[model samples]
Structure formats: structure tokens, C-alpha cells
Target: MEIKEVKQRKEIIEPLLEVWQKSVRSTHHFLNEKEIVMISQYVPSAFENIPHFIVGYDEQKPIAFMGIDGERIEMLFIDPICQGQGIEKN
Candidate 1:
């Protein structure tokens, strides 16, 4: 797996959303659609002057993603299939 900073909500959101929703539903048994949409809409601005939005990929496919909000981590999600691989620690 490789990690990089992602810009452009339009480019990163769909993959992030897919992984996030799947992971959440499988693990937490709940769907936070409104929160997900808010995050999708807020991520770009959330990183306006910050470093990269950490995104993890495997075999060129997006596998995990995280957003930084100031000094805190606002969101993190890895593909449900990839959970035990320590992708989130990246």
C-alpha cells in the first residue's frame, strides 16, 4: 500500500465514501449518511491550508482515507476487507 495526500473533493470523495460507508455498516451497524455527506462537502475546506488529506491505496485502488481538522483527526475509514492490515495506522 502507498499513502499520499489527496486534494480535490471531486476526485477523492466517491472512493472515500464507498470505503467509509461499507466499513461503517459492516462494523458499526449504522448508516450516518448525513454525516458522510457533510464530511464529503467539508473535506476540501477542512484541508485548505493543511497538509495532504492522507489517502491510502493498494494496487492503485483507493483503500482508505482520513481527514485532518486542525490538530485533530476528523475522520478515518478503511475498506472493510482491509481492516486488519493496519491501513488505518498509515
Candidate 2:
């Protein structure tokens, strides 16, 4: 496994969005269907504005990602299949 900085936001946007949606659906049950849809509409633009992004990979497959803006973490997501593997800890 390895962690690498993401230099191109567009390159992984699709997979990143997939991971984000799956993660949110599994974890953020407080959000109603309408809120989920609204947030979904905004995620892409938010992703575009993140200044720092990194991805965790197992071999060549991306398993998790985190986005940072200065000191605050804007996003962190793991592929549901890869959850509980402690990818977030490292």
C-alpha cells in the first residue's frame, strides 16, 4: 500500500466521486434524500477547489482519498470494500 499526492484533480474525479457517494450513503444517514441530492450537486465544485488532495492505493488501485485546504480537512473517503482496513489511520 502507498499514499500519494494527487496533482490532477480531473484525472480521478469520477472514482473519487464514487467513493464519496458510497462513503456518505453508508455513514451520513442523518442526511435525508433531498439533502443528499443537494450535497451531491455541490461535491464536484467543492472538489475542484480543494488545494491539497492525496490518495491511498493498494498496488495500482485507489482505495481511499483525503482533501485538505490549509489546516482543515475538506474530504476523506474510503472505498466501502476497503473499509475497516485502517487505510484512514495510515
Query: Residue 66 in model 1: shift from native, Å?
Result: 0.6
Predict model 2's lDDT versus the native.
Answer: 0.83
Candidate 2 local lDDT, residue 90:
87
Best by lDDT: 2
RMSD of each candidate relative to the true structure: 3.5, 1.6
Model 1 regions more than 4 Å off: 30-52
The prediction achieving the highest TM-score against the true structure is 2
lDDT of 2 by residue, 8-47 (tens): 7787777777878888888899998788878888887777
Q: Could you tell me how far off, in angstroms, the CA of residue 44 lies in candidate 1 after the best superposition?
A: 9.2
- Model 1 over residues 1-90: C-alpha lDDT tens digits? 999887765666566667776777667645476765665565455545445578789988888877786788877777889989777666
Q: Give the TM-score of candidate 2.
A: 0.85
